[model samples]
Target chain A: MTPSSFVKLDGVAKRWNGQLGVEGISLDIPEGSFTALLGPSGCGKSTTLRLLAGLELPDEGTISIDGKDVTTSAASDRNLSMVFQSYALFPHLSVAENVVFGLKVRRVSKKERQVKLHRALEITGLLGYERRKPGELSGGQRQRVALARAIVAGQRLCLMDEPLSNLDAKLRNAVRKDIKKLQRDLGITVVYVTHDQTEAMSMADTVVLMKDGHIQQIGSPDDLYSRPNNTFVAEFVGAPPMALIDATAFASVFDNSATVGIRAENIQIVPSGQGRLRCVVTESEFLGAETLIGLDHAGASGLCVLKPGLAMVAEGSEIDIDFQDESLHVFDADGQRLTG
Target chain B: MSAHANLERRRQAIYGWLLLSPAAVLLTLFAFYPSIATLWSSLFSRGTRRRPSEFVGGENYTDLFADPTFWLVVKNNLLYAGVTIPVSIFIALSMALWANSKISARGFVRTAYFTPTVLPMIAAANLWLFFYTPGLGVLDQIGSVFGLPSVNWLGQPETALWAIIIVTIWKEAGFFMIFYLAALQTIPEDLKEAADIEGASRWTYTRRIVLPLLMPTTLFIAVNAIINSVKLIDHLFILTKGGPSDASKLILYYIWEMAFAFFDAPSAAAMTIMVIAVLGVVAAVQFFYLDRRTHYQ
Candidate 1:
């Protein structure tokens, strides 16, 4: 493990009855950085978070947090807190009671508990909700309570497992900013797990995309979006996803086995018989500010072009789309990114 | 429009009454009428062939107050309620927690814990009857193997109520456990995980989270256990018939004796009225007080 990494996992592997839960996992998280484990459901993003939280022990390799080996440490012994997807606020407990639960468990003095609880509640904007039971609070308020509880202990490391998944869309957006601000203000290292690309891209300093029990790519959001390491990352990390085109279509430039990838924003919808490749408009989705025009081609999947304004293109209309040769991401037959 | 609104209101009123009619009819026929009839009968004197039944207000109530046997049965039931309600609830809670854990043979364990509930109470009493049958019983057989004396369980005043209490607890704990198990499952596993991360010990989690979450279930089980202490006297008939000296005589058993064995219907009716009043107050207290404090999801 690197000395500079605040939390490090060295070749960590976990399994369920000899089946692959997660394998050959290695990561180094710096202090006070937001790292999101992003993937589809059942992609072991949750397994990775649980392993880091010390909730699940890996079958092989070591996990270290804050430069200490916590491979087999109990969750509490690791001195880290967690925010569950369900919020997990004790239903019978008031908001103040839930926030101070960890402090009380750690036997912190009454005065200190009160001080910390007050500060945590204030930071989460839940000052007036202290006396409310979780059941009595709105979904957004309950989420803040979970956040307050996670931070009340002043643990330097916080693990959040899709904490905003339970909230509605508008509340999710607000809480997203709140959580990002909270992490920034506290300077706490966070390991967040999410299946939502928007959440990961918008908040995380580093986004680790995984597929089928293995890390596909680990980099900044821009790195995953602009330069995906594999075909899966290309398709999984964007809003509309990157389009995949068979290299055979670009007969002169690419190897027959290679696949070419391009973003919708980079592809321009030129007039028919003028652009490089011909495509038929499959569907058009008007997203207020911009309309996304989905295109269908013989050798491509997820071909789309972003048109500004309500560009209602008719379905089955032939259109020619073009992208600069430099913008094309070339992946070999094995689906691994090929360096220029 | 106002007429249409009135018509709609009338339709809604009719729908509401239609929905409530079944319950109202059942209660009036079986519960309300019987309670009022019992009260009316309690105010009258039992009739012989020579003298017809006559009004004797407060006489049967006073006679019950003067009866030593009634006091003894009341005391016996009080002790029974105190022991069986708490003990059975405690056992049920423990059994529920154990069975809900991730253990091997979990299905078998749950089935074993639930077996007593599946058996009829009389059949269960019969099964315990074999265990309390002096020299030929299971308890005595085990005692003898340990070189201990085989004492008569059902025939003695001191041990008869205790033996019945044990039987009631054994038969009841399993039934209460099913409710506890259902309540336990409703408490999400996430709470335990959250507690684990909070540095709370397992016992602390149980006390702070699990136990409080189970308050509604505990209150329900307590009410059922109290009612069963009085109502489930079927075992008394099969085991001791309210015992050698009325030692195991619960209030319901004594009431049955007053009505059928002694043919004193008025006194039995008075006792039943008292039972109903006490139960009503208790149910009201539990509903009003504990319901507000409980967190139901």
Candidate 2:
């Protein structure tokens, strides 16, 4: 382990009722980095977060924080804090009380606790809302209160499970930027869990994609987006989803009967003869700045091309869609990456 | 022009009133009538022992004020409420926390703690009366084992009320535990986990997080325990019967003695009105205290 390794999960596995919940997962979270555990529901992403939080004991392997074995440590001894998705504030307490609850529990002096509570409230932009109950706050405000509570604990490591999932889309976007900026500014090591791929792609320094209790891939967001090691990562990381085509038809493009993947933005709809592949535009989605065209290729099949918003392609228009050979992604029969 | 629509509207109105009238009448008959009657009765006076049935306006209230026994019973009620409310709620909270802990045989333990709630108070009082017997009783036997004095619990004026209070706490703590358990379960596991991660010890969590979160339930159970302490009289029947110089007799038991033992109906009615007045004040205090705190959810 490196000296900067903040949290390290070494060969961790968990089982319940003779069923595997997380199996042989290993990763190192560097200090002061914002990492995201990204996967579909039931993919054990939340389970991995819970394991790191000491909410669940691993049935095998070991977990450590800053090189200390914490597998057997109680959650109270972990020196970490978590913000739940539900924003579980004490309903009976005022906002100030909720934020200072941890300090009070640790028997900190009331004077120091008040100082820390004020600082946390200022940081979370909840300074004047301290007198109100949680029931009186909006969902976004409640989330801020939850964040304030976590911030007041002063623990170096913070775990968040879908913290912004409960907010409206507009609020989610705002809080997302706020959280990312806060994480970067505070230099606190944060491990966030989310099923929203966009949330992971937009906020993470390192993204660990999980599937069925196993670590599918662990890399920087740019690395996973630009050079996915498997078909699952390729399919999971991008929006409008990576259009998949059977590579067997394009014999010159690949040497095997593999699945070829290309991001929607990579494919271009060009005039015929300017491109190597020809297709008919079946449908089009006109986003504000770009238009996505769905194309039906003769053999490769189900190709989509993203074009500038000004491109006006009528229905049933014959268009040639193309990408550079280097931009092609090839995967074998089992969805394992063959070529980047 | 729309006869059927008119009939339907009429049907809905009739059904609404039909559904409402039963409760309205029951409340008026059982809840409202006695209250109004008690208030009316308080305005009357107690007659002489020979006639015992004359009316002089507000004279009974004045006589009640002059009677030292009335003030003593009021003091006893306050003591009972003070002791039982805090003790029962504390014991219930502790039991609920224990029953909800990650211990072995939690279900069996919960059932055992809750068993007293379902047992009749009269039966429990009878059983305790046997245990509080002077000699050859289980309590005295245990006291002898501990090398304690063989003092009669209910036969002494000093200890009689406390003995009854102890029995009341035992009888009602389990009943209140069920409310506390429900509230405890409603507290999401995440808050507990959050407190744990904050380096809070178990006692700190109980005192800061768990107890504060359970405030509404505490208020609820406190009100219930207070009401039950005021009204319940099985202990008065079995162990003390207002004996040892009437030190253990509650206001309701005193009213029962005045009405039946001495056959003084008007004075019993007057005392009954006084008890209701005291209870009304306590109920109002609870209502306002809880009203300010009710979250409505």
Candidate 3:
């Protein structure tokens, strides 16, 4: 209901074949911001995107775009555009033709459609390849064609479902940067779906983390990464996931049924007696610029510590573990963060 | 160059031939040899077996070109292919879309539509003959009950070919539909959703996205439809038998009558050669059309 709000889902629910795909969910995507719905497969992230795209109607509640109720509106009338994961370019159409398909469908004049198609292709850096079919393009190039098709429509809202997942790592990185740059330049609101937390963290203005058909935490990427609300978010957001340790081992550090979370890079591996906990190194992985020491502690859950340079200790080598008191996140029996 | 190199090359050639021997033998016996024999036979006179005949190269072809009956049969074949291919394709596309939609009893409906495809074409031809009977037939009965004139469905020259075309379309549309259905199903759901969000109307999406993507399947069905129309001859036997005025006659029926009914073996062989040539041309056109469109996915 806010002025700058571009899309809103109110009590939206959807089910398929008697199974709950998405439960009552309410959220808003503001204008001119890139947001990502990040979740694992079948976690209802794609389902949420489908509902917002008007591809699937919510079983309960309403959906709105630009403050207009469009819950029952046909998908064709929704004034939105989407890029599919498959990069679903028409195989028989040239790149320019694919980009102009929406305009042609709307009966736009040929001259106008041509101008828009060229602009879209140029923006996507596909200017010289207008006459080529999608089959002739590489995976990354095909993805750009899909992007161009969506961009040429110039709809108020754009939805992308794992658009870069099909590209190789190198192309994915390049396309990811291109997507963020294009979003900033165009000021178009985008609701991107990706299972890659890194994609969400790097490209999204706001990240909506979902799990099992429910929204886990919706916040800026840094907020979700640094101050996750539950065990799920804490574990889901970071690469080389946050190390969870039994808080009871350090009874002085906690007052209740013990739990503590530390990100991989947060836990420091000091000399054997510099910290409160004593541990034995189990395994170590030498990543460039950092070494992840997998350790075993007495009366505590296993921990993976990111230390500078090569292995500070060999397997079965006794090592001291330490984390700043303020950096250690303490949680209760139910995995909710507990305050001091 | 060297003895071992030569030996290895010979071994590869032997293995290659061994791998291809079955297909090569079958093609020579069934396709290549028969076609050559038919072409050779077409160059000879159609005299009785007791009298030795002399070669008359291209005479059969000249005679076929000159004959009004042969031209009429060719025209009939073209009419059959032209009408049946387009009409059946249209019906198949429509039926595929309808059956694929969120219709209640979709499986049952699909089964019902496809049931005719499995029935023997000869048996189906006989069944349609009963329906086309004048006055007391099912079609006539239905027409008379509505106070419409009960016209002879297949007896008349003007209506016989049309009646055959209708039955052929009805019989084959479902078979063609299964191909279209498979093509339709292969189109990613994401593409359809993308079109919908682009504000493309249903017709626009189908025309621009669905149809073009299914081009391969369309060409496939078209080639098969033409082949089936030209080669198959069940309807002629039950309904018109080359018609009141040879109206419902197809090339195959004419060939049958030429060889067996008229006992003109060389003429029949010549006509058969022509038919094969026509089929080859049609097949070649399809091959090129398909070659250009194949996505190599």
Q: Best TM-score goes to which candidate? A: 1
Among all windows of ten consecutive residues in candidate 3 chain B, which has the lowest summed lDDT? B288-297
Interface RMSD of each: 0.8, 2.0, 1.9
lDDT of 2 by residue, B33-96 (tens): 9877766665655456686555577776677679788778777877888898899888998999
lDDT of each: 0.93, 0.84, 0.86
What is the per-residue lDDT of model 3 for residues B1-297, given as tens digits with 9 covering 90 to 100?
699999999999999999999999999999999899999989998886697777999998899899999999899889988999999999999999889889999999899889889998888998897789998789998888999998897889899999999989989999999998888898888677777777777888888778877788888898889889987788789888988889989999999998999988788999999888888988897787676865534
Of the candidates shown, which would achieve the greatest lDDT relative to the real structure?
1
Better of 1 and 3 by TM-score: 1
| Candidate 2 residue pairs in clash (backbone atoms < 3 Å) | none
- Judged by whole-model lDDT over C-alpha atoms, candidate 3 comes out at 0.86
Whole-model lDDT, candidate 1?
0.93
A1-340 in candidate 1: lDDT tens per residue? 4545999999999999988899989999999999999999999999999998878999998998987899999998999999999999898999999999989988999999999999999999998888898889899999999999999998999999999999999989999999999999999999999999999999999999988899999999999999999999999989899999988875547654479899999999777777889999999999999999999999999999999999999999999988898899989898999864
Model 2, residue A127: distance off in Å is: 2.7
Recovery fraction of native interface contacts for candidate 3:
0.77
Best by DockQ: 1
Span of 10 residues, lowest total lDDT, candidate 1 chain A: A249-258
